[model samples]
Each structure stands twice: as structure tokens, then as C-alpha cells.
Target: MKVLIVGGAARLGPHVIRALEGEHTLRVTDIVPVETQHEFQQVDIASPAEVHGAAEGIDAIVNCSVEREGRRRAAFDVNSRGCYNMMRAAVSHGISRVINTGPHFTIQGNTYTTFDYEINPDVPPHPSTNPYALSKGVGQEICKVFTENHDVHVLTYLFYEFRDHNNPTLRGDHPFAISWRDAAEAIRLGLEVDLATLPSRCEAFNIHADLPHQRFSNEKNKRLLGFTPQDRLEAMWQRR
Candidate 1:
């Protein structure tokens, strides 16, 4: 597979790259230069023209590009419109597989619930009435439209708080954490899952560590993507 990683070389990009290494051919793109050995092209995903041009001959697109938080207009422009542009480019270029990165807030409330609960990925998002959430919500909508109207396979992974797992500490069992290894493994599943086996054309999955969260469930994602999370915060913390 010839995969193009949007926002490659960003915070999580290198982890993803390491996971996919030796398994697939790779290309990268971002507004900034990628300081890696992989081939990269300068691209701003907000521009349809830029994305489409770079999208040609690509087998899959992993959209990891995100606008900085607190920039209202920039968030909408880059996150919302950028998602639309990626799907549109995929449709035009005959690229059928896409992996889009999103946030857990798309399904869970920004304010953590006091009680433990499980949230399926299909649950309707209740975004706080804010630009960041609203923009991401709109981006999910765009992914839906593209996958339904066009013959495309889209994987939207909604990740929670992620960090390196060295000597991990728990925030009183908050139940939302994805270690770097777990995150990269989830991305690997997104890249390799068979489209014919999916329940829908466009699907979103909540990807986090295997914490016994009372508020979130990754069971559906496990069935859909064949993922079994390797990092358990408590287990790793004890080892440390």
C-alpha cells in the first residue's frame, strides 16, 4: 500500500510511521517540512487543490493534520474544510481508503462524567457549543457524506488523552489515556482492515488504552478493526 500521511512528522506522525514501516510504502505531507527519510510534499489540507494534487496515485490517506487549539477561524478552516477536501480528493482520485483522526469529545462530553459509562462510537456527538468541537463535528459529517455518496472506506479514530507510557501515572482512574504504542497499533489496524468486512462505509471508533472505563467502550472498535490494545495503564505503572 502506498500511504500518504497528512501532517506527517507532527506529534504522533513518527509513531505511526514506525508502526507502518516495512509493511507499506509511504509518503508524507504537511504545511511544514518533514524531517524524516520518507518522501514529503508541502501541502495545506485546507486547500482542495493542494490535497488533490498530492493525493494522486495514493492508495490511502491518513489525516492527522489538526489546527492549533484556540484559533477559532483556523480550526474551522483547517479541520472542517480540510476533512472535506481529503474525502473529495479521494473520491476524485479513486482512492477508496482513508483514516481520519478525531477527538473523543466528538462522542463524549468535554466535561468528564463522574460515573463510569460506556460510549459506542455510533452514539451521536454532543459537542460543547464551541468552535473546536463544532468544527470537528462538522468534519465527521463530511466523512459520512463522502463515504455514503461515493464508494470509499473511511476510518475515523477518535483518540483520548495520549502520552508516552514511561512510568505511567493515573489521574485517579480517569479512564482516558492512549499510550504511544497503543495509538500506533490502532493506526496500523486502520491502515490494514479489510473494507469488505466493515459494517459501514464510514465508521468512527473510540481508541484508547484498555482501561476499564465506565464511560467508554471500545468493544465495537475491537470487533471492527481486529484491535486488542496492548497498553494497560495500571499494568505498566505497576511494572515501573
Candidate 2:
């Protein structure tokens, strides 16, 4: 597969690149230059033209792009409009598979935060009014709509905390924390899964390591995408 990774220079992009590097040919793009062996393009995903150009000749798209802390216009441009541009490009090129990523709050917001257990990804998204969450929530909706109307099949991976697998001593308090490698693996599975196996054209999964905290469920990821976290992250919660 020839994959185009938007925002390929960002924090999570490298992990994803590493995960898919040897198995698939890659074309990485970002606003700034990226130093990599794979094909690179300077693309601001908010621009429809640039996104379309980047989508050219790629078999699939992995949208790692995001705008976390910025003004409303910038956030919407990247998170909301950027997603619209990507879907349009996919439709134009007849690309059927796309992997979209965002924070877990895009699906599970304040409404589910108060709940103690079994907060799954299938619930209605509240997203509250937080700029990042709202923008990302809108992006997910755009993907859903595109899937409904087009041949495109979108698998959205929602994540929270990310832990470096090498840092054994580091532990996060968040119930949804996952090792970087495990998160990347989830994206890989999303890309490879057979479209016919999916229950719908668009599906969302909460990507996280196996943790004792039942606040969020990874069952969908396991059953649908066949994702199994290599890093259980037990040390994070276990007492010495």
C-alpha cells in the first residue's frame, strides 16, 4: 500500500511512520519540511488544492494532522475543513480506505467522564465546547457523512494519553493511556482490515493499552480490527 500521512512531521506521525515503514511505501507531508527516506511533500491540509495534490497516486490516507491549541479559525481550518478536504480528495481519486485519528474526547466528553465504567466509543459525542474537542468532533462527523454518501470507508481511531514503551518508569494516571507502539499498531490494523468485515462504512474505536480501569472499552478494536495491545502497561497501576 502507498500511504499518504498528513501532518507527518508532528508528534504522533513518526510513530505511525515507523510502524508502517518497511511494510508499505509512504508519502509523508506536513506544513514544514520532513527529513525522511520516504517521499515527502509540503502540504498544509487546510488547503483543498494542496491536500488533493498530496492525495494523488496514494492508495490510502492516514490523517495524523491536528490543531490542538490555536485560535478558532486555525482550529477549524485544520481539524474541520482539513477533514473535508481530505474526503473530497479521496472521492475525486476513487480512494476507498482512509484512517482518521483524533483525541478520545471527540467521542467521549463531559457526559461520559462522570461515569465510572464501560465508557465505550459507540456513545453519542458531547464534546462540550472545548475548542480542540469540538473541532475534532466536527471532523469525525464529516468523515461519517462522506462514508454515508460515497464509497469511502473511514476508520477513526480515538486516543487519549500516549506512553513511550521504552520509558518503563513513566506512568500516566489517565485510564485511556496507551503505549505509542500500540497506538500505531491500531492505525495499521485500521488500514489493513477488509472493508466488508466492518459493520458500517464508518466506525470509531477507542485505542488504548490493556488497563484495569474500566472507564473505556477496547472491545470494538479487538473484535473488529483484531487489535491486541503488545504493551499491557500493568506497571503503571501495579504497586511495587
Candidate 3:
């Protein structure tokens, strides 16, 4: 299986790259030059031509792209339009699967509310004032729309922050975090899962190492996608 990773030079790129290495054939693209040795394409995903050109012949694509916070126009272009262009290229090329990184803050309000129930993927994303979150939410929606119109299987992973490699403890201040290794594994599963077996062609998942607060449920990651993080933040912290 050949895979293309957009924004593959970003902070989380190397981790995803490491997880899929030797498991599949790989290609990488980003606005700037990708640092690692695998075949690299300097691409601006918001540009349809560049995305289509980069996507040619790829079986799968994992979008690790995100614009820096507070840059409103850049964020919309990269986060929203970028997803649109990728799906356009994907559906055109007959690609089977696409994985997008949607921000966990898409439903920013859910995190602060005192709801007795845990937040799950089924919870609608509450409108957010934060530019970054709003843009990413739009991106996820675009993925869903494309999936509805095309034969592709789209999976969006709402991520919070990457945790420390050696110490993946749940800090009291932070309710969500995923170790780099776990984050990578999740993408691997997202790419391999068969859409025919799923209830829908499009789905979004919350990605994080298990937290004791139970603020978010990752049951879908385990049951639907076959991903179960090895490190539980609470368990790792208790040993210390």
C-alpha cells in the first residue's frame, strides 16, 4: 500500500512516518521541504493542482497539516480549503482512504461544561470563537461531505497535544494528551480499517492516551478502528 502524508514536515509528521515505515510505500508533501529521506513533494494543500499532482498514484493520504494559531486567513486556507483540495484530488484519483487531523477544540465548549456524561465523537462540535478550532472543524466537515459524495473512506482524528515520550502522565491541568507512539499507531489503524465493515464512510475519532477523568471516550478507536493505546496516563503516573 502506498501512502502520502500531507504536511509531512510538521511536528507530528516524523512520528506518523516512523509508525508506517516498512509497513507501506510512502510519499511526503508540505509547504516547505520535508526533512526526512522518503520521496518529498513541496506542496501547498490548499492549491488544487499541487494536491492533485502530489496525490497521483497514492493509495492513502494522512493529512497532518495545520496552520499556526491566530492566523485567521492562513488557518482557513490550510485547514479548510486544504481538506477540500485533498478530497478533490483523492476522489479524482480513486484513492480508498484519507485521514485528517481535526482539532479537539472543535467543540471547545464541551471541554469546559460540567456535563455529567463524557464527551464522545457523536457529540456535535459546538461553534468555537478560536480561529484555529473553527477552521479545523470546517475541515472535518469537508471530509464528511466528500465521503458522502464519493467512494472514499474518510477518518478524522481530533487531537489535543502530544505527550512526553518517556513520561506520559496526565497532568491535572491537561485533560487530553497522546504519546507520539500512540498517535502514530492510531493513523496506521485509520488507514488500514475497511470502510465496508464500518457503519459509515466518514467518521471522526478522539485520539489520546486513556485518561482517568474519562472526559472523552475513545471506545470507537478501539472497537471500530482496532486501536488501543498501550500507555494509560493514569497507570503510568501511579507507578511514579
* Number of the top-ranking candidate, with TM-score as the measure: 2
The candidate with the higher lDDT, 2 or 3, is 2
Q: TM-score for each prediction?
A: 0.92, 0.98, 0.92
Best by lDDT: 2
How well does candidate 1 score on lDDT at residue 167? 49
Regions more than 4 Å wrong, model 2: none
For residues 1-240, write the lDDT of model 3, one tens digit per residue.
999999888878889999998798889899998777789999998899999999999999999998967989999999999999999999999997999886677654545445634677767667366788888888888888888888999888888878766764445435567888999999998878878878898887889877776777888899998999986666444655
Clash pairs detected, candidate 1: 116-214, 117-214, 117-215
Error of 1 at 165 (Å): 2.4
Instruction: Tell me the spans in candidate 1 whose CA falls farther than 4 Å from its real position.
Output: 110-116, 168-172, 235-240
- Whole-model lDDT for model 3 versus the true structure? 0.83
Residue 156 in model 2: shift from native, Å? 0.5
TM-score of decoy 1: 0.92
The alpha-carbon root-mean-square deviation between model 1 and the true structure, to one decimal in Å, is 2.3
- Candidate 1 lDDT over residue span 49-89, tens digit each: 99999898999999888775888989988789999999999
Candidate 2 per-residue C-alpha lDDT over 31-135 given as tens digits, one digit per residue, 9 for 90 to 100:
999999999999999999999999999899999998999589889999999999999999999899999999989988888888648888888877857889999
lDDT of 2 at 228: 90
